[model samples]
Structures are given as C-alpha cells and as structure tokens.
Target: MTNFQQSEALSRVQPSTTLAVTQKARELKAAGRDIISLGAGEPDFDTPDFIKDAAIQAIRDGKTKYTAVDGIPELKQAVATKFKRDNNLDYDLDQISIAPGGKAILYNALVATMNPGDEVIIPAPYWVSYPDMALLAGGKPVIVKADASNGFKLSPEALEAVITPKTKWLIFNSPSNPTGAAYTHNEIKALTDVLLRYPHVMVMSDDMYEHIVYDGFEFATPAEVEPALYDRTLTVNGASKAFAMTGWRIGFAGGPKPMIKAMAKVMSQSTSNPSSISQWASVAALNGDQSFLKERNDAFKERRDLVVSMLNQANGLTCATPEGAFYVYPSCEGVIGKATPNGVKISSDEDFAAALLEDEGVAIVFGAAFGLSPYFRVSYAAAIEQLEDACQRIQRFCASLT
Candidate 1:
C-alpha cells in the first residue's frame, strides 16, 4: 500500500457542508426513504428559453472554440453594459475578468493578490467558501461575527474593530447566502465609509443575488454606494442564481485594470477561460429582456414567506424574513439541550440537524458549517410544495423534541 498525504493548503479547507447535506438526502431517498431537502443554494427554476436559444445558436455558429483567457470581447462588452445599466457603475472591457464560476472568480482574485500572513476580513454567517478560500490562498481569515439583531449584517464599528495593517481584502456579499440579508444603501455606505479609512484593504463585493430582493428592496454594492472605494473594489456577479444558470458555469467581475489583469493571469495558468458557449449565452442573458427576473423574484418571495411562516411555527425554531435570496437562517436555540423522542440529546445545531434528518428525513445545513452556531439554514429554492412539506417535517421534529 502506498502512503498518500494531502497538501497543507488542501488540509485547511473543509468540505462544503451544504453539498454534503444535499448528497446525503439524495442517498437516503435512493434507498427508499422519503426525503425533503432544503439545503442547496440553487434556484429550482430553469434558465429562461431566450438564454438557452442563444447557447443553441452559438453552437450552430461554431462558437465552441476556446476563447480569450478571461472572456470573449462580446461577453465582456455585455458585462460592461450590465454594470452600467443595473449597478450604475462603469467598467471598460479591459477591466473585466470572467471565470468558470463565481467561486473560481473569487478564488483567482485571492490567489492573485493574497500573500502569506495577509488577513482577509469576512463577516458571518457567510458563504461556506469564503474563509476556506482565503486559507487556501495562504491568507489568514479574520471572521467578524455579524449580530442577528441587525439582520446578520456587519456593523461599521465591528468592521473598524477588525482592521489591521496587514489586512488585504474584505469579502462582502449582499443579498447574502444562507441568511439572505441584504444591506440597504445607507448600510453599505456606512461600511464603505469605514473602508475609506483603510486604503490598504480591497473589497470583493459578491452581488450574486442582486436581482432576487423582495418587497422592492433596492440592491446596492460597495463601489456603487461609495465612489471613493470604486478603485479598490471588485464587484462580482454571475449568471447562476438569479439567471437560473448554475450549471452554465459563468462568472465575472469588474475592477481596477491591474487587478483584472492579474486575475486573468491566474486563470491563464489554471482554468484558461469560461465555456465559449456559456459566455455567448451570458451575453444574451445580460443584453436580452430582463422582465423575467421580476416574475422569478415574485415566485421566490412567495416561497420565502411560506418557509419563514412555517419554520417560525415550528416549536423550537425562529425564522426571520430575509430581504432577498431564497434562504432563511433560523435560530435553533429552542431545541438545544432537549432530547429527541429516541433519547438522542440535541446539544448543538449539528445534532438537531442530524436528528431531524434521521427522524423526519428533512435535510438542512447546520449553522456551524457557515461559521455561526445554534442555527441552521433553509434554502427556499425548492418547489413550494416541497418547502411546505419540509417545513412541516421540521415542525414535527421540533415538537418531538422532549
């Protein structure tokens, strides 16, 4: 037998808990157990027909060849137009970089910029990959816990408290994953104001869920809110969540020309370019009709309401109505220290999640997986019927806790 060892960089990263829970649910269902999974951070809707048609047309046009290292010119132009039109931010084609996915885009930026011992500030509960990516890039992850009282948003004071001379980047996400808590323009301005004092710290704003806001919540990014930070901000968006094109693997960003070039250099040595067909499809997605987005937002809002209502009805769960995205992070503090019907003690969010899955076959990601605790995330991106059934099962599981 040969002895194999993982690299130190790989050892520091944890497997994605969301994907693990989703897969476990699949395995259980395959074995004839009834399962309701609310763990994936993907939209249940299909990519619009117009976008698919563009991809088909591209294939017929033989646009399947490898493209520029970062992206094709047409797609870059489309992305530039999108930034100007939707975000009120301007970017030249040379200032943009496209990669296989949003994750890849962020990873490339970190790898291109981070040095050993550099600090990356992250707010929790954050996306599962932020800290791990920083660690993989040889940067220390400085996690600042966001308070639940303020809708899981980081405060300006909290932001200031974590700043050190060695800080390199602050990874910000609006319409956040897991919690779906979007900051208002004033809230963003407050944080950007703090960032203005720390000129050494760059901002990587993930606006992946920009179009998924509810109740007319206007989305704003750091650079859009604070022009002073525009030169230091990398505004990242993609054709995944809002566009229902996750499998398309298209993500992009617009930033300073030098940073953009560096990210492209990193991509050149790794995944050279995003899929050519997907790039063309994304062009059409950005330039084509955007009316379908409103329709999808309406549907997501309804599902969010249903999940929030039913989860709050659960005996030991308290869910807050998020401003955007398809996820709801609910505190499971009420179930802690309680024993399951089978005498399994729920000492933590992980235990509660495990017991719920074992007893009711409802799968959800535990909050500790996202750098928070005594809470769990429920993605309302599933069908409304499935969400209702999952919520009911969660309620039953909570009630069964003695």
Candidate 2:
C-alpha cells in the first residue's frame, strides 16, 4: 500500500461550494428526483448567435494553433476598445491579459503576485472561490463581513479598519455573487478614497456582471471611479454572465504593465493561451452590436422581481431585492431553531439548505459556504416558470417548519 499526502498548499483550500451544490442538483435530477437547482451563478440565456459565428469562422480560418500565451492581438485590441467604450478606462495592448476564464484570470493574478503571509482582503458574503484561491497561493485571506443592513456592501469604514501593513490585494466584486449587490458610483468612490491611503494594496475588481444592472442602476468599478488607483487595479470581465458565454471560457483583464506581464508569464507556464476559437468569439462579443444585452437584462430584471416578491412571501424567509446579478440572498433566521415536518432541526443555513433539497427538491447554496450565516443564496437565473415553482416549493417548506 502506498500513502499519498496532499501538498500543503493544496490542502489549505476546500472545493468550491457553489459548484458542489450545482453538481449535487445534477446528480439528484439524474436519479429521477424533480430538482429545481438555483445554485449555479451562470446565466440562463444562450450565447449570442453572432459570437458563435465568429468562433465557427475562426475554425474555418485555421486559427486553432496556439498564439500568444496571454491573448491574440485582435482580441487584445477588441478588449482595449471595450475598456474605452464601456469603462472610460485606457490600457495599451501590453497592459491586457486574457486567460481561460474569469476564474483563471483571477487565479493567475494571485499566483503571479502573492507571497507567503501576504493578505488578500475579501468581503463576505463573497464568491466562494476568493478566500480559497488566496489560501492556495500562500496568501492569508482577511474576510470583512458586509452586513445585510447596508445591502450586503462593504462600507468604507469597515474596509479601512481591516487594512494592515501586510495587505497586498483586495478582491472586490460588484453585482456580487451570492448577494448580487452592486455599488453606486459614489459608494465605490468612498471605498476608493480609503484605498488611496494605502498605496500598497492592489485592487482586483471583478466586473463580471458589469452590464447586469436593473432599475436604472448605474454600475461603477474601482478604476473607473478613482483614477489614482488605476495603476494598481486589475479590472476583470468576461463573456460569462452578461454575454451568456460561460462555456466559451474567455476572460480578460486590464491593469499595470508589470502586473499584466506577470500574469502572462504565469499563463505561459500553465494553461498557455486560452482556446483560440474562444478568443476569436470574444473579439466579436466585444465588438458586435450590444442591443441584445438590453433585452436579456429586461428578462433578468423580471425574474429578479418575481423571485424577490415570492421569497418575501415565504413565512420564515426575507429576501432582499438586489441591484444587479441574478441571485437573491434570503435570511433564514426565522426558520433556524425550528423543526421540519420530519422532525429535523434547522439549526444552521446548511441544515436548512439540505432539508429544503431533501423535502422540496429545491437546491440553493447556504450562506455559511459564502462566509455568512443564517441566510441562503438563490440564483434566479432560471426560467421564470421554474423560478415560480421553486419559490412556491420554498414557501411551502418554510410554512411547514414549526
């Protein structure tokens, strides 16, 4: 018998809870269970046809061979244009990095820059990957809990209190995963103001859901709000959420030349360039007519409202309507300490989630998995009818708890 031990770095991180929950739902559905999964953060929309055409054209043009380790020149130029047009930010070709996906882009940046004992500040309830990724890169994760009272957004005072001399990075996300809370321009400016005091902390702004705002809500990024922090900020966006291109696996970042070069070097040694076909498709995604975004956003807003309203009606659940993204974080505190019809005690969010899945066949990610508690996240990215059914099931389950 051979004893195999996990590496110290690999052992430090847990699997992504979101992906795990999504997979569990898939398994349950495959086993003949009628499961309505709201665990995935992916959009329910299909990738636009024009973008798909570009990928097909690329294949016909024999663009299958590997090119630059980071990105192709055409895609880089397109990304540059996107930054200028959408974000009012400027970046030269050398200051851009393209990777397999947004997750890869972020992980590459962390691997390129993180040193042992360096601190990466992340706000809770954050995307599940942030803290784990930091731990994997030999960096310490410093989590700051953003309260629901403030719409689950990080306050400048709270952010200022968490900063220490060893802090090297702040992983910031707007239209955040798990919570879907987007910050206004002035709100972001307040946090950027605090960052101005700390020259050493780099900002990794995940603007993956930049175009998913609702109700005339304007989206703002750290670099866009504060020009002084531009050099230290990596503005990351991808075709996943807004463009419904999750399977395309294309993510790009614009930042300081040194950071970009470092990320490219990391890519060169690891995944090399992203899929050549995907890169071409992303160029079209960035440069093509964006009229479809408005239509899709209108649909997302409807689903958001429906889910929020229905969840609020649940006996023990109170869901907050988010500014953007497709998730609703509902506090299940009222259900905690209660007993299910099966007599199982719902002492925590995890218990509540498991019980809901077992009893009602509705899958949702629990808050503790996202560094918060007494709450759970429901992704309303499904079809409206499915969302209605899931919400109804959730209400029935909540009402049954006593």
Candidate 3:
C-alpha cells in the first residue's frame, strides 16, 4: 500500500475554524439541541431583490455559459466604476479581475505572485484564511501582533519591525474579520508611509466589509487613501459581506495591469471565472442603489452595542466595542485558569469555546484560530433576540466557572 499523504501546501493549511464551529453548531441543531451560533462571518440577510432579479434575468437571457477567464467584460467594468464612484480610485477593465469569492481572488493573486521562501507579513488576529493561503502558496507567514489596546490595529512601527528583504506581501484587512477593527484613513496612511520605504512589499487590501461600518465611520482602502501606493496595492472587495451575497461567489480586485494580468492567468488555469450569473448579480450590487447600507449598518451597530455591553457584564469575560463588521473579539483571560462546572479547566480560548459549545450550546471561533490567544470571536449577524439569547447563555456559562 502506498502512503497517501496530503500535499505539502494543503498539509500546511488549517481548515477555517470559523466555519468549523458554525458547522458543529449546525450538527447540534440538527440533533434537536438548542444551539446559538455566533461563528459565521457572513451577513444573515438575503441578497437584495435587485441583485437576485439580475441573476434571474441573466439566466432567462441564457447567460449561463463560462465567462472570460477572469470576469465578464460588464462585471469588470462595473467593478472599475465601483472603485471610482465609491472610493475615488480609477481603474480600467484590464486592471480588474474577478474570481469565485474574495478568498479565491486573494488566493489566486498570492499563488500567482508568491515564490517559495517568500515571507508574507500578516497582523495578528487576522482573517484565519490569510496565513493558510500564504502557506498554500509556498510562502512563509510572518505574524505581527495587534491587540485590543490599539483597537486591534497594527501600527507603522510594528509593521516596519517585521519587514525584511524576504518580505514580498503585506495583507491588510480593515473592518477586520474576527475583531471588527477598522482602521482610520490616517492610520492607513501612516502604515503606507512605512510601506513606501519597502517598495518590494505589495499590499493586498481586503475591503470585503466596506459598507458595514457604523457611527458614521468613513471607509477607506489603501490605494484610495494613498495614491503613491496605488501601483503596488491590490484593492480586493466583493459582494459577499456588504451585499449579503455570499453564495453568489463573486469577488473582484483592481490593481496594476501586470498584477491583475497575472491573477487572471492564475484564474484561467484554476477556476476559469466566477459564476457567470453571479457576476451579473455582483454588477448590480456594485452599481445599484447603496442606500440600504446605512440602515443595515445602523442595525448592526445596535446589535454590537447590545452584545458588547452584555458580554462585558458577564462574570469574567471582557469585550471590546468593535467599530465595524459583525463580530466582537473579546478577551477570556479572566476565565483562563478557572474550572468549568463540569471540571474542565479553561486554559486557552479554544478550550473555553469548546466547553461553551458543550455546555451552553453557543458556538464561537477561538482566537487561537486567528493567531491570537485568550480571546474568542462572536459574530452578531443573527437577529437581536438570538444575539440576546446567546449572550445570556454565555453569561450563564461564565457564571458556572470557578
């Protein structure tokens, strides 16, 4: 018998723990247990009616064939218009490429650009996929810690200390996943100034949650905020988070012509193009009325407030008020070294999350999965009642700790 070991790229990767916890909660719910899942990093709402209608119209028009390798011409044009209209950045169709999702586009770009022994700098408590994607591209992930004190943002000094001759890419996610930390324009500019000194580093700005911000916080991307970095920055955004179209699987990136071409080449070989119908849907999402964003973000802000307050009032846990996105990354340091009612010692965030799922039927991703420790991510993308119930269960579970 031959050994069927996994490929080195895949073996180096870890499954997305966010999805893993959400799936476990689904399993428990299927078994008739009362499970409250705060692990999904997606919007709870349905895709807007206009976007859905566009997809249906595309199907009715027999537009279901394979698209151009990177994207359909119209979709790419829409993406380009979206950058100019929303972010004040201009891009032509040749500099734009679309893929199955934002994750796929990022992976394709990394695979096209990364070489073996390359170092990719990622800030801690980042999206779980970033490091794994780098590893899958045969690149080393160098993590720099960003914490609650800094609003979970990486300072320029912190970033500069990590960059070396081997550094090829720097992945930035504002309105960051897991933490909901959004960087200000000045903060991004400060980091860009540091990056300017390191011309070898290409920036991949993941702006998936560009529209989900609260408290009148303006959204800004790298290329939009700093024109000098425009040539080296790949601005990645998608219809998934903002437009509530995750299953549609459409993401687009705009960058320098050469980088976009390389990413398109990678897409041509691997996944070809994003779903044709979904590409049309995403076009509608990008170019259609954006008024719904404020209402949705206001609702998210109320829920974030509710969750943050309740979580902080819990016996031992502490939570930060995130600026944007649907998640709250809270510290469980107080609970560590304590014992659960069932005698399980809570030593790490993973153990605490596991115990919470087992006892209270509330699911959240551990911070360790996101390269941070003693914290956990709770997504409040569900209804207010469900969020309240989950927080109540978490409070009760915390009360049971000794």
TM-scores of the candidates are 0.99, 0.99, 0.98
List model 3 lDDT by residue over 7-93, tens digit each: 877988898888888889999999999999999999998888999999999999999999899999999998989899889999989
Candidate maximizing lDDT? 2
lDDT of 2: 0.95
**CA lDDT of each prediction against the hidden true structure:** 0.94, 0.95, 0.92
Clashes of 3: 0
lDDT of 2 at 166: 97
lDDT of 1 by residue, 1-402 (tens): 389998999999998888999999999999999998888989999999999999999999999998999999999999999999999999999999999999999999999999999999999999999999999999999999995988899999999999999999999999999799999999999999999998999999999999999998999999999999999999999999979999999999999999999999999998999999999999999999999999999999899999999998999889889999999999999989999989999999999889999999998999999989999999988888888888888888899889
TM-score of 2: 0.99
Off by over 4 Å in 2: none
State in Å the error of residue 115, model 2.
Answer: 0.7
lDDT of 2 by residue, 52-111 (tens): 999999999999999899999999999999999999999999999999999999999999
Instruction: Please state the error at residue 153 of candidate 2 in Å.
Output: 0.7
Lowest summed lDDT across 10 adjacent residues in model 1 is found at 1-10
